[model samples]
Target: MSEAFVKGCEGLPWWRGAVIYQVYPRSFRDSNGDGIGDLAGITEKMEHIASLGCDGLWVSPFFTSPMADFGYDVADYRGVDPIFGDLGDFDAMVARAHDLGLKVIIDQVYSHTSIEHAWFEESRQSRDNAKADWYVWADPKPDGSPPNNWQSVFGGPSWTWDARRGQYYLHNFLKEQPDLNVHHPEVQEALLQVARFWLDRGVDGFRLDALNFAMHDRALTDNPPVAEPKQRTRSFDFQHHYHNQSQPELIGFIERIAEVMNGYGARFTLAEVGGEQAAREMKEFTHGQDRLNSAYGFDYLYADKLTPQLVREAIASWPGEEGEGWPSWAFSNHDAPRFASRWWGEEERPRAVKTALALLMCLKGNAILYQGEELGLPQAEVAYEDLQDPEAIANWPLTLGRDGARTPMTWTDSACAGFGSTDSWLPIAGPHRAMHVAAQEADAESILHWTRKVIALRNAHEALRCGEVEVIDEGGDLLAFERRHAGHRIACYFNLTAAPLALPEVSGSVLLATGDVAPDQRELAAFSALIVETQ
Candidate 1:
């Protein structure tokens, strides 16, 4: 790698209190009039991303794949898919992003690869092959059934039969995304090679997908059933997922990845972890300086209501101190429904959106802003026939498909909403066109302006960036907390309910507010939020 590729930040930590704008490349922009987003398309929009006042951009997976799980199931790690452009386009995109002062972080799916991956194909060929131990393969039971009772996240047995090997291999998600055997030394080396390849290409960091699932029980034990019934449809929910994921050895592997990143200076790494024991495991994975820089769980992503109590509990769990891992919070993402539609109905959508944005920006840890969230876009209602996510389709009626959150970006009111010349890969209709980027840019009070202003405020305030949070009070629907650093303190308050709220007993000046605030008294309207700096 060139010196520039391994360049370290001068006296700065790449991740501390960073605002990362997440780009779902497929829905971000389109070039060549292909309707689907490509690397070149991202390069064209680098300026808009930089204008958002974020320190970096985290682009989701866009590697060569069969689109089985969109871009999560990688067939080629080093090369970009033809649909998303090739390696050259990715390099150009990286250069352009850097020129705009935006650090580029790409997704890395090391836990599994598409069955079409050459390693998986060769491993399944024969037991004596050079890559036979590349994937997590095992023999079946005497009854010709799966080795254990583990279940796939897509609603079936976790083990799938292979006609050639006459055995079953474990898969935590879809059958096509077979789990890799990270336990093997050779497998670890191969995965590291994939990371090094990207590092050589000048990518700043990686968002490791399913980091907990990278290791599993070597014995292939059956996971015990859950005591309570699950309300969701994923087959994996029936059990506690003991043998399938969150193995202790996963930390050692993360340490190895961290060592590689350390060699490259200021490169950052974050894990996407979620499960029954996710919070505990997340802390463990990032407890030390040698592990991942940060980890994010589903606490905020799956939350139905953003209450004061919920916010307090989530923040309090991770106290800012030495030896404690940092957190990356996200209210909405590509995998789940948008927070605007999920948290508030159409009546309170605009206020709730602004409040949510302010809360996320003021939080002490790193923040991830999902695509289209700045415009207060609601989840699109997709018909059954148009559904694409396998997890959603399998659990239809019970859980909405992720396609609703993966709709194309509404850039203009023109046909296709200025996303492309042709129809979008996913439908874009209803209130989406009216909430287009052009329309929002014309409206001064739009959510986009509120988001930019809050982000700027957070960036400008040192206390809001890396301060320690202390819950001041959680009375009624009012949430109040203090962010303090180097004797500087700022109080953040939120009226989560649909009613006016009086400020807590704190002598401070209102620094920022999502809505109008009375000057004489610290009063805010319903669903409002404010940040006040101490005198």
Candidate 2:
């Protein structure tokens, strides 16, 4: 959880420093033995989330889609995909969640829609159609090539030739997921209506997907070339991506969205901002209360390793200033390889994960815990033949691909890891089965139980929830800080390396401890963490 959701922080908004759980629908659970998770499955599991002490659950798109980009390409913004369930199931799921005191935040892919969407179908048929300019369209250059040199994040050129319209359309991702011309007033209104549709249906808020790419520079100018490219796999990584995304025009639309959300009671907004200018855009999109409630960057998601320097830099980005929008942090999500695999070797994984969670919960921003994170699930190994993510397939072995992170969540030691009666949409990692919910639930010392305890601890402390952070020590492999709220102060110390270190002598009552620590409180084992209440 971030620094905005303390249990006893009177008069403060519930979402200020709330902890949200992200559930990738297809891999979360399968109820009807269809090898895929559905709304019913998520509803059945709401109790687990509520028990975990999360403020809410953020469900990735379940809207009608063609499975291109796996639900990011929306065909119908209002309709739930049949594979997931119908609208009735969605309403029921919302009801169950509310019943369990959990807020529901659904993903909104306003930047683009599937090529099969009604608006796109009409717009692509001819330039004279009612929705002709609904999407970003341009003519070929005099040489009959693309109008600009912008590249798609998924690979190849961002523009695709359209025979019917005789123009090239922009797509920052899969060609099937056409970018929307958000600059158009009509397009912005249409998206707001989509938000209204969901808000009326009782969703607590939204997690805007790839929000920074929603608008592009209208001049169709070429993206500048990178001066120094590093270990590039796709052409997209070689460009500076200036004109292609993170346009200033985006802030206006974000304000418009925030206006609509303001009309609703306590509705929250979170943007997933990624790019070379992510830090800048994150601040821009969420500058004030009138804009997005908060935004999360890719600092931790794509990091090759977790270091004291990394934590220091990330926390420094947002100081929780008076008018500055709050921040959210995630160690693992559906898109990147799990942090357990990225940050530590097999021998240190268990203790490292525990300390990581303590660090995450103790941080100043909202914390987003992805499904299976509580169980210390690492990235699964999905063979090439079983791969499903488009970006991963395009880059092949060069990229780890997102499929490994999107594999089925382990529920039990039974066949299919008790995820479903049939084979899951993706195979379960063999090792994950041993760490399933059932096994961990029975073991009092398991990561799953520890996750609950850490979350509860955060909820019980006002200082940890929405406190101001002071970095006391970020030297070498040790990171120590204090979270201050009102008159209370809590000190958090972490040994990030794989070797024991002398503990920092701080006068305070012991609040929590993870990993091996000498009884005398003089030393901390590798990957250990200690939390102290100094006031």
Candidate 3:
């Protein structure tokens, strides 16, 4: 039994302070040599996930799709796309994960469905069909233009014209993804059935994608503009997004979702909520009884720098209270640039890697560690011709998009980098290959080892897992905090800068230390993180 398990969470669940590794299925592993990763491929590589010591794995969407928005635009909720494999393959993968002691959380896209989905196809046929009102259909304004001034996240207006219905249908993302009429009771029942299908298939939980966008304001209203410090790269960034998403009706759907999952025992539910109103939305979506178990924000995902203030604000947002919900933290994921490249310059990345890993482990909430983070993989350079992500293609020279960070995982130093024998879907260049898992597994000083140590430390201490967090200092280069669980006090400190920091007077037995830390003389080198026990 883990020392961290010495005392069970007073009233909390296993996922309260767990670590979940995200697997972007398309680039994880390719078993068929089809240049695309599949469910069978993931099954073949389950050992790597288990070795990470993460409590579970969160796999991205693999539902039948038209490749629009990749798998995010689901064509069918119950079927696995042929490219990823069949339902049998999914069942086998889930069984394999359970055998390896890892919980499986699949992605569920509730906000919208691909234009090719049977529901959408039927919804667009005619206004009088059984499924005609299944999607958000609206009549154009007086000038026969879009219903409102809302913009799609990819580009252009959020409403698409349909000749059959002779009305515009809402699409908050790509035009290929038509927004579902979530307010329809029939739609809610259909979604509940989808959850039941997955739970019966043996999934332990779900990672709801763009959950806030699941419902939209019924009245066709225009969205207001916003003032921002950063230049607006896309049209979606120009507006406040009030009428288009984060509707209050979404909470009721979450309650229904909880009901469906709760019927299946201890199933996990995590919401990927993002927007200008994320702070309030997260609490509303997760707080109190019968809501989502947890929700994550885009705070650290888009952060240009890893400042103490940033960490403090994120932690302070989710204080464990009577009715407050739990928070989930993620530094990197499939949708944004890798944290290493964003936070540290190329020359100083190695030191920053160790410190960042340490910092994430010491946090209070559940940590979502994206695939390949353990190897300290920085964002790979994806040339324009090599980019696969639709977002990058849509916003070309204006933004790097997410293709750079979504490059295929590097597993070896060979030509195919041990991913497969043929050319992969996305490029796996020399830089990524240099930090391959094989090389890191052999090097004691590798970022891989450091990651394992940090995860191990978290598993060995309840104080670091589900403890009550209190910020001691968050100024300059130092970010210090104390975590207390069952009267056991632990102090965690980190230097998130390139210069030395004077160590404060600390009375504790050192549990873990990385970088330059001289306790006797009271000094810590650049990018140092030290953990200790007291009382």
RMSD of each: 2.9, 1.8, 1.4
lDDT computed for candidate 3: 0.88
Cα shift from native, residue 480, model 3 (Å): 0.2
Best by lDDT: 2
Distance from true position, residue 18, model 3, in Å? 0.7
lDDT of candidate 3 over 1-535, digit per residue (tens): 2434735666566777888999999989998998898899899999888887888899999999999888999999999999999999999999999999889999998889999999998989999999998899999989999988999988789999999889999999999999999999999999999999999999999999999999989997799987772657788888889999988988899999998888988889999999889999999988887998989878899998999899998878877778988888999998888998999999999988988999999998888999989999998888899988788887887664588877888888888998888999988866898899999999999999989899988987888888889999846668999999989999988888888888788876888888544445377778888888876
Per-model TM against the reference: 0.96, 0.98, 0.98
Error of 3 at 106 (Å): 0.7
Candidate 2 local Cα displacement, residue 374, angstroms: 0.4
Provide the lowest-lDDT 10-residue window in model 3.
Answer: 1-10
Residue 440 lDDT in candidate 2: 94
Q: How good is model 2 by TM-score?
A: 0.98
Better of 2 and 3 by lDDT: 2
C-alpha lDDT score of every prediction, in listed order? 0.86, 0.90, 0.88
**Residue clash pairs of candidate 2:** 1-367, 2-365, 2-366, 2-367, 3-465, 3-466, 4-16, 4-17, 5-17
Instruction: Give the worst 10-residue stretch by lDDT in candidate 2.
Output: 1-10
Which segments of candidate 1 are over 4 A away from where they belong? 1-12, 518-522
